[model samples]
Target: MATRRYLQLDVFAARAGTGNPLGVVLDADGMDTASMQALAAWLNLSETVFFVPMQDPAADYRIRIFTPGSELPFAGHPSVGAAWAALDAGLVDADARALVQECGAGLLPVRVEKTADGKRTIELCTPRRQALSTPPVAIPASLQALAAADAAPVLWSNGPAWWLLRANSAGAVRAFAPDFAAIAAFTNATDATGLVIFAPEAGAGHDVVVRAFCPGDAVNVPEDPVTGSANALVAAWLAAHAALPHADGRYVASQGRELGRDGRVQLRVDADGDVWLGGEVQPVIRGSLDW
Candidate 1:
């Protein structure tokens, strides 16, 4: 057995323990797919990432993301956490402001910067946003009951697909108690990663409240504390529908409070219609893994 570096990080958190947790294995060059899958299952987080050598010269690093049950082409928290891990491990230049990540979805650009308060933040540019033409899946009765009458559900793809819906208010989003089985069934039937419900918020520190349920066949996560991809898609949906509350096309999303965690995600839809998602990543644990 060889020893490898391991990092546990909280992604999109304003503080420690307030974001989605990710497991990262560094220098996992020779690890086979089965071994990576086994380790990810053992970690039992929403997703675990294995940092491998770059396959493309343009990429600064390559990562393989896995959930407990299966592998994903890409994921938000994992990508953010892996980038932080890479910087912390000296895999990339400490002062580097940009990086290109190679994954199943392709090479994605990442930006590292500091907030005005001097807090470190990482933002990732997601794949081209696509509103799929597939007929909308029937929303579960529970979700349908809570959905906003003014907005219809939409299916969005940016590597992982999500069913996006709007709620009447932030309170409704926070009070939403999902029927996991029913939602899971819906996601499976629609071949989506999860169902995301969000609502606009005012004077609440954040501009939007978001929640993601992923008890689907693709992954084992029940409630994702903070989801990067879903938030990105939400931003795109808002922009496309000309529903952006902010004229700047930027918003902060509040999530995970229903699960006793407070997660914040930063979202911006550029003039070119590119969605960028990012937030603070707090390092929780750094240790060695025996494999």
Candidate 2:
């Protein structure tokens, strides 16, 4: 009924149109929750972000994240995409070198690092880690059949709930064809977003290669080109259990090769054990929405 401005963003992309796509609906104030959910379902992307004036007094702006199926308390790519969209709309300034984001998870601090070319890298502080129960036998067996890693599947949450499985090599992660039926059953039983399979070292410019798979009954996203929250969980777990060999407390991770998209996520663990997940965003389409 009215015109609104929005941005289509590519998160964690090394190039345009190669990263995960996000729709940031700005000027979305007064839009009812049902309308927002309907629009998100219509958009049919992994997730859509809606921005409005701050509800929390401490936050500069408040954002709501919705997938086609349901709403999420927090999401990585949407947070990054929202940050870029907010910056573009003058909702935030970099004077303090940080941005605070308020969502279902609470207030999160985001670091703003600007490059020489005026491109900015935004690193959002992930919520404290929440380690959940282990995966069922079938889940581990499913991954074992494809790869030779014995590492058990771990379910954890930084924002949205997740399950992580470790493979022996990055090649193993790349070559496997997922059994979505079995995986969906596992997800149903465990209430996790999906499975994230990763290896210690791989890729040309990254320390680790991660592949995320989300299988569902009807509307399913077989693979996520880039996932911020999953990698954040990985960083927290590894920092606590097994430290990386060359870790200067920060490293770059690669993902999305299965989808032919070169996506990179920069994860850092500060001396205080805080995990920061970040990436560069590229605006693919800048326009106004009328609907």
**Candidate 1 lDDT by residue in tens digits, 157-248:** 88888999998888889888899999899888888889899988874668888999999878868999899889988888888889887899
Candidate 2 positional error at 66, Å: 0.9
Q: What value does the lDDT take at residue 52 in candidate 2? A: 70
Candidate 2: deviation at residue 255, Å?
Answer: 0.5
Regions of candidate 1 where Cα sits further than 4 Å from its true position: 115-119, 135-137
Pairs that collide in candidate 2 are 1-291
Q: In candidate 1, where is summed lDDT lowest over 10 consecutive residues?
A: 130-139
Q: What TM-score does each of the candidates earn? A: 0.96, 0.94
Candidate 2, residues 212-246: lDDT per residue as tens digits? Answer: 87776322567778988888888887787665535
The true-versus-predicted C-alpha distance at residue 109 of model 1, in Å, is 1.2
Lowest lDDT block of 10, candidate 2: 213-222
